[model samples]
Target: MQFTQIEYFLMVARLEHMSKAALELEISQSSLSKTIARLEDDIGVPLFDRKGKSIHLNEYGRIFYKKAKKALDDLQEAKTEIQELANIQEDSIAINVMNSKLLPKLFFDFYKKRPNVKIRQYVLPDKLAQQKLIFGDIDLMIVINPIVDQRIEWVPLFTEEIFLVVPKNHPLATKESVSLIEAKDEMFIVSETGQNFRATENHLFEKAGFTPKIAFEGEDLSIILQLVNEGKGISFIFQHSFLDTYLDNVKILKISNPVCFQTVGIAWNKNRKSSFVVNSFRDFAISFLKDSANKDFSN
Candidate 1:
């Protein structure tokens, strides 16, 4: 019935775990459980079917969730509008990106133009980014892989071709570009299996008709680059890597033959009216990269 309760309900429903939701919301688990139980009792129906260590929403829960979501969204919109009418700048936008390094540059250039807006940036893996987008948790996402959703609108930001990175003294490091087949026999230092870039590596190997001899595995880009620089193995990176790092011993080469490229873009909910902050940030991000074409990025 209360706004606070509605917010708690949405969080609980989204997570479907009492302890997890409670930890996230900074409330006691028992308090959260009691609150949900009371809400369900008041409605004379069970919202969630509780099994050991799991919770699934029932039919009534689904119906209530749909209505509750709309009500909360409408309330937020009303508040935003009212704040605007009073000449107050009060709005927050959440951005989910795989690369954490891109956020500061993305926001610094954007937020300078709109100083009053609040920005929340999250560094997440590709699958989680798409999941959060579909769940309406994040307002916008900058994803490398294309997320085709009817309710989502995609705007092209930049196109980056994957580069083969090696130690400066390596023979292949002198080449401007190397074909996938040429590097087929080389060792790879790649991300984990479920990661987007790892999948891209798999596809590259599949196209070359040979499995790469992977020498090392890492999640962080710096560590991966360090591994490569130490002559552990070669790795793939966006062309931006050349400009972003000061590692003197690393060399970058474009991948040719297949000419593979990842399409980076801005994605937002099509059904929702985007705020000025979101749109402005979007415009700034696209223009910043375009203006600095062939320039280096730090990460």
Candidate 2:
């Protein structure tokens, strides 16, 4: 019925023993028992199954516990939002980059607007970025496949196709588009296994129904492009990555069977109190990426 009652109920639900829950809650066993009894009376349901020294939540109690936890979460989120709105601080923003291809220009554009603000950026693997976000070590994450977490909020910026790249002289290069099955046996030059782009392309492999035969693993995009150019092996990359660059003997082709694409997004830890600079950058990134996607689509 009340916040304290709900909180006590949740604690008891977690611990499943009244005396243990009371000890942990720093309340007397008698008081805790009376409060829980009052709560059950108000709710008009027997919430717990008791056997002298042992206690466990019944079906009604289980349902109530879930709803109570969610209600508390909503209230906490509202409180955090209000506090952030009331205090607009201009702190340095820390960002992590998992999808690195598009972030340079986006960060540069933001830097131009807020000339006095400092924007710290780091390129990290998937797991480390998530740990940093959870611990409040980072403010924003630019990623293709955003981390899925209840406390993390993500906003989509743009989507781009992942193109198959091969040496221009390769047989498949002559074809406009071919299914990944067409080159199932070809050795693949790829980024290291755990990188974000590699992870996205890994899904394409799953959809295409085969694992790639790896010829080499390149640490950077240019290395992959170079290896592909030499006819060493074929690779996959984003369409927008090499749009302005000249590909001497490399061809960016399309896979028709299972279309490979990734949606890039900006993610932040909603639990952290973001500064005005970080929020403004987030707003600016949404618009800038929308415009970029439109312009690229038109071209």
* Candidate of highest TM-score: 2
Q: Between which residue pairs do clashes occur in model 2?
A: none
Q: Point out where model 2 deviates above 4 Å.
A: 1-91, 98-104, 242-247
Q: Give each model's whole-structure lDDT.
A: 0.76, 0.81
Tell me how far the alpha carbon of residue 235 in candidate 1 is from the true structure, in angstroms, after superposition: 0.6
RMSD of each: 12.7, 11.5
Candidate that would win on lDDT: 2
How well does model 1 score by local distance difference test?
0.76
Number of backbone-clashing residue pairs for each candidate, in the order shown = 3, 0
Query: Per-residue alpha-carbon lDDT of model 1 for 1-299, expressed as tens digits?
Result: 56777788889999998899999999999999888888888788999989998987899999999999999999988987766544377667888865534456757866566667788888677667767777778888876665677888777766767778888888898888888788777788998776667777788778767888888776566778778878888887775443336567877887777777676777888777777667666777777755453354323
Candidate 2 to native Cα RMSD, angstroms: 11.5
Model 1 misplaced stretches (Cα beyond 4 Å) = 1-79, 82-87, 100-105, 149-152, 242-246, 270-276, 283-299
